[model samples]
Target: MKTGTNNKFWKYAKIITFLLTAFVVILSGCVDEEQNETESGNTTNNSQEITGTTNNQGTTGGDYIYGTAKVKSIQIVTLESFPVQVQVIAKGYLPDGCTKIDEIKNEGEGNAFNITISTKRPKGAFCTQVITNFTETIPLEVRGLKAGNYTVNVNGVNGSFELPVDNVPEETPGSMSTKQQIITEADNGTSISIENESTFYLKLKENPTTGYSWELNLSQGLNNISGEYCPPEQPEGIKQPLVGAEGVHLWEIKAVSKGNQQVMGIYKRPWEKVTGKEENFILNVEIV
Candidate 1:
């Protein structure tokens, strides 16, 4: 009876050990599979992180953004009391795989404004990997704020501008309507006509913060186009240029009167002199 009982005890012990070993192997496999899945789904985590960061833009705290998105320019539309209005514009040279803006967010109050934008690839997409460029404008408003200094944040860019109590008119958006025509630097050696009235726009690369700007030197026939034109003056084509960054300095002149004239100017520090007028231009004009 003792021998039989001992044999039964050993048999039971071996069975328990084998079962325990099988269970451990199965558990280990499940654990490894879970780890692999987590690794493969990291892109989801990245996207979630971006969403969180984007929500933080116009706010003080949130996730910091990561990517190539950036603000290209900003303009104050109204700094006076009725309500503060600003126009923030941005641009991107996206990778070929990206075809459109995926999201856009703007937040904050009169004192601070934040803007965020993102681009994405189309779903089930077949896209060529090429570089492309795009431009976008974000209009922001803060109600009931009077003239004062304000902050604007576009994506991760920050800027400070004042809202003056003075009321100045802005330029007519690019005109193809009236007898007026808009001309640029590209028309340097060409001739332009003004039967009714004409607005001539001369643009060049400039850095205003460096005290370097373009000024129109009216030479009799051509008059300057400077009557309350574009209060919060902005460069026609260049988006948010930095303080010392290069941008297009647009100069305008309204030609009214008949006969021939010339528009001339130099790009330099106002207090300096232009010896050869190397950085200058002489544009021919005709008014009737």
Candidate 2:
């Protein structure tokens, strides 16, 4: 009788153990599903994702894998000398390294710009590095408007910026003097050392017609004297003015401190969900 009792106890124990194991598996599966759902909320296809950069040298044809980066926002700001300022914000969840923005244009029919911010491969860069997500802002210049209406769109979202009569610059070109030194796209990775307070003129190449623009990532210690979009310089040998020509983004930064600070920019489309980063640039400045 004791032997029979022992057998019964062992059988019941086995059944309970099996039930617990099944329960654990089911619970684990549920937890995994929840995580995936949350990620998918702002997620797109890995192929279309622009969160970070990869070391692989791929083309737009999907031959290679690029970092996922896309647009976050685009807005137009009206300041003293700047009549039309396009501010762009892009994100790279995975950044390969620092990439320079190639171009930003106005591609849309009604004053739309396309932003082309891509990584600049070094002399021997394989570009396989993929870092985590970080946000970047790039500024583009826009000018020559007749004080009318315009639209700045990012990731399919539109931000309307108006140039009121009061914000217009003086008609007499010689009356106003610019106190800014410009910083262009080529100034990336370069450092500037200053003793007293100084200002910078940041000019970047942009094509706003394709829905891309630039903006200054607001920071402390640096005073913004002015920001504006200057009209594209008329290319030589061209007679007629092009409707949407290549342009330059002009931004002025006043450094008021005497230490080290890093300036950043991001080029992206703001409306779509992303998995990687757009193009990014980091500028180092020293005030001594």
Question: How accurate locally, in lDDT, is each candidate?
Answer: 0.63, 0.59
Q: After superposition, how far is residue 101 of candidate 1 from its true place, in Å?
A: 0.9
Error of 2 at 46 (Å): 63
Q: Model 1 has how many clashing residue pairs?
A: 4
**Candidate 1: which pairs clash?**
72-240, 73-240, 96-130, 225-253
133 Cα displacement, candidate 2 (Å): 37
Q: For each candidate, what TM-score against the reference?
A: 0.34, 0.34
Give lDDT tens digits, candidate 1, residues 5-70: 999999999999999999999999999999989987897899999999965564444223335454
Residue-level lDDT tens digits of model 2 in 1-288: 999999999999999999999999999999999999878765765634554444344443334233224555443434333443545555434355544333444354545555544433334446667664545565645555555566665445556766564334447754433544446555677865544476777777666666666645745657767767665556579866456555666777888877787678777656654445766667887766
Candidate 2 segments exceeding 4 Å error? 1-181, 234-244, 272-275
